[model samples]
Target: MRVKVEDLYFSYPGKDVLKGINLDLKETDIVCVLGPNGSGKSTLVKCIEGLQPPQSGNIIFDGTNSSKLSRIEIARLIGYVPQSSSQLFSASVFDTVMMGRKPHYSWRCSDDDIDIVADVLEQMGLANLSMNEYNCLSGGQQQRVLIARALAQQPELLLLDEPTSALDIAHQLEVMEIIHNSVHKRGIGVLMVIHDLNLASRYADKIIMMKDGIVFACGAPEEIFTKENIEEVYGVEANIFSHEGILSVIPVRRSDAKLVPESLGIF
Candidate 1:
């Protein structure tokens, strides 16, 4: 599924967040949104998932306007995995994942629904833990379970908010690889809000940098991860390098005093 956001504007009470944001998500693209804290990256994803409505703008998904679709209708098209895994219920892993079929289920779950949920659990490597309590699993395991839930929804578009934030490096790579494979093989469009620049550069087909609720830059990872762009948007100096076909970002730390050298010198 392709998503088009035109003239998007959103604000909370007494505060303006997203400002005239426009973006296009192509099918099978792994697009990552990067920004400093409080830059509205999460808000933009929420708007795309129809969890929060844009104050003024159009969210068109595969040519259908998002506003016209009900929550369940939208869920059928886009599945969201939020940053906080703790928001999940205390249900067993199987039941938690089975909930993803709510949009397709009538009051009762059919045999087909059970088969689909089982398939997703196996695909996500959670089949062995399917009977365990969801909250008792490790952080990475829980994250994968949540993703399995989203996958069982059979959505054409997947919106993830910092999916790898709490995982270790190994788990991060594992989860990202799973997402990459799913996008390539299943043809699902992925839009994720991520904080790690190198991860974004390495995994994302395209990068969108946000600053103060506006898109600062949008392009391929190579085009958007330059030192100048990184310093300007993230307020840090980063050395961007590529090996073979992989891109990497390394941040160079600066002393707080040196960061405002001119002001310090005057003092």
Candidate 2:
């Protein structure tokens, strides 16, 4: 799926969130949105998924306005993995993943749905836990399962928010590798919001650096991950260098006395 976000703006009654955001997501592209907490990363993903409409601007899906697509239509084109979910009951892991197949099936799930779900479970190292209670898993395990579900959807594009926030270093690398391979091998477009600058730098074909609910920079990782950009976006000074053939970032200290606002937490 190809998506164009044009002049997107979102806000609450008292404060603005996304400020005239614009970007392009193309097939076979891995685009990562990078920002501190309160920069509207999550909000931008939600708006793109049409879960919440932008107060202004348009999200065009393959040249069609998001408003013209139904929820089911959107689901067929975009697989969304949110930051977290509040499950009211202990649904089985297999069933949780199967839920992503809803848009593809009508009276009942097809054999393809079952196979896809099973494959994603195996890829995510959760095949053994297919029958386990989802709520009983640890935070990292649950995050993996959520990602598995999104993969099972078999959508053209995947939108993820903080996909590796709960995992240890090993699992984080594993997940990033899986998503990277998914896009490169099959022309699946992925737009993910992540905080780890090095991971984004290494995997993303394009990087979007956001702050104060607006995009401060959009370019390739090497161009967007400059020392000045990091200091401006996160209020921190950092060392940027090439390490072992990979771009590396090491934060040195707070850049200034100005602290990121606590009130922007909800945005």
Candidate 3:
């Protein structure tokens, strides 16, 4: 699916959240949004999911304005996994995932819905926990279950907010690998907000760096993860390394000097 955000502006009474944001996501691209805390990463995803309305501008889903689509209509096209799983209603793993099929069912779930949910559970490695209480699972396990639920929805666009924040490196790789495979195999577009710069560099096809509720840069990981970009966006001086085509940053010290916009150059 092709999604476009044009001049999107959103705010609360006391503060602004998203400021004239513009983004482009094409079919099957894993786009990761990166920023420090309170940079509107979550708010931007929410606006695209239609969970929150932007004060101005528009979100175009495959050339259709998001405002024209109803809540159920948006849900049918976009599956959203919030930043915190606490916002989700807890149930047995199977039933919780089955809830994703609500958009496709009128009266009740069908055999197809059952099959889809089962397949997704297997894919997410949660088949063994199908009957387990969702709330009883560890944080990583709960995150996997939530992702399985979203996959069961069979949406064209997947919006994830820090889906791997709670997981260890192993679980993070597992979840991101699953999502990467799913995106390419199913030709789905994913917009994810992630904090780990190394993980984002390794998995995301495109990286968007935002600061102070504004997008500071957007490009491939190599272009976006330069020493200057890191110092400017994160306020840290870092040693950036590249190994086997993956870029990783080791923060050595705090950078009190702000990098001048023109002084910073991309490699």
Candidate 4:
């Protein structure tokens, strides 16, 4: 699916969170949103997913205005995987994944739903954990299960919020690889909020950098991941280098030179 956000405006009480935000995401594209805290990355994704509606502006999916669609209709088109959540119930992994089928089924699950869930679990490498209690899984495993549930929705677009948060390096790569494969094989458009610049540079086909509730820059990784842009958006000094078709970001320490007070918050 192709997603286009035009003049998107959102706010929280007295504060504006998204101001004139615009984006274009195409099928099979991996677009990552990068920004500091309070930059409206999460809010923007929530608005797109219909979890929260923008006060003004349009979210268009495949040339249709999202406001014309019902919440369930939108859910069917966009699958959202949130950051982290405490398991409120001890549902089995298979049952949890089956919940994604709700948007498509009104009554008991049919053979197609069962097959879809099973296929998703196998593709996500979660077949062995299907019957396990969801809460008992490790952080990485749980994250993968959440992703699997999203996949079972059969969405044309996937929205992920910090999919690698709290994961070790190996687990982070595992999750990113799953997302990468999904885009290339399933041809789904992915919009993710990622904190790690290096990870975003490595996996994202395009990067959207936001600052102070507006889009600061948006383009291919090489175009947007420059040292000047990094310092301007993130308030950090960093060296950006490429190795074997992947970019690596290394933040320069304050001890290397005299730094301002704001440098303390640099990521």
- How close to the true structure is residue 128 of candidate 1, measured as C-alpha lDDT? 95
Candidate 4 residue-wise lDDT, 1-267, digit = tens? 989999999999999999999888877889999999999999999999988989999999999999999989998999999997567878999999999999999989999999999999999999999999999999999999989989999899999999998899999999999999987888898999999999999999999999999999999999998888988888778998899988898988533345455667653
Q: After superposition, how far is residue 68 of candidate 1 from its true place, in Å?
A: 0.4
For 102-162, candidate 1 gives per-residue lDDT tens digits of 9998799999999999998998899899999999999999889888999999999989999
Deviation in Å, model 1, residue 7 alpha carbon: 0.7
Residue 48's lDDT within candidate 3 is 93
Q: In candidate 4, which residue ranges exceed 4 Å CA deviation?
A: 254-267
- Among these predictions, the greatest lDDT belongs to 4
Clashing pairs in 3: none
**Deviation in Å, model 3, residue 254 alpha carbon:** 1.1
Counted clashes in each candidate structure: 0, 0, 0, 0
**Candidates in order: C-alpha RMSD to true structure:** 2.9, 3.9, 5.2, 2.5
Model 2 CA deviation exceeding 4 Å by range: 257-267
Off by over 4 Å in 3: 87-90, 257-267
Higher-lDDT candidate of 2 and 3: 3
Candidate 3 on 116-215: residue-level lDDT in tens?
9999998888989999998889988888888888888999999999999989989899889988999988889999999999899999999999998889
> Candidate 2 clashing pairs?
none
In Å, residue 135's CA in model 3 sits off its true spot by: 1.1
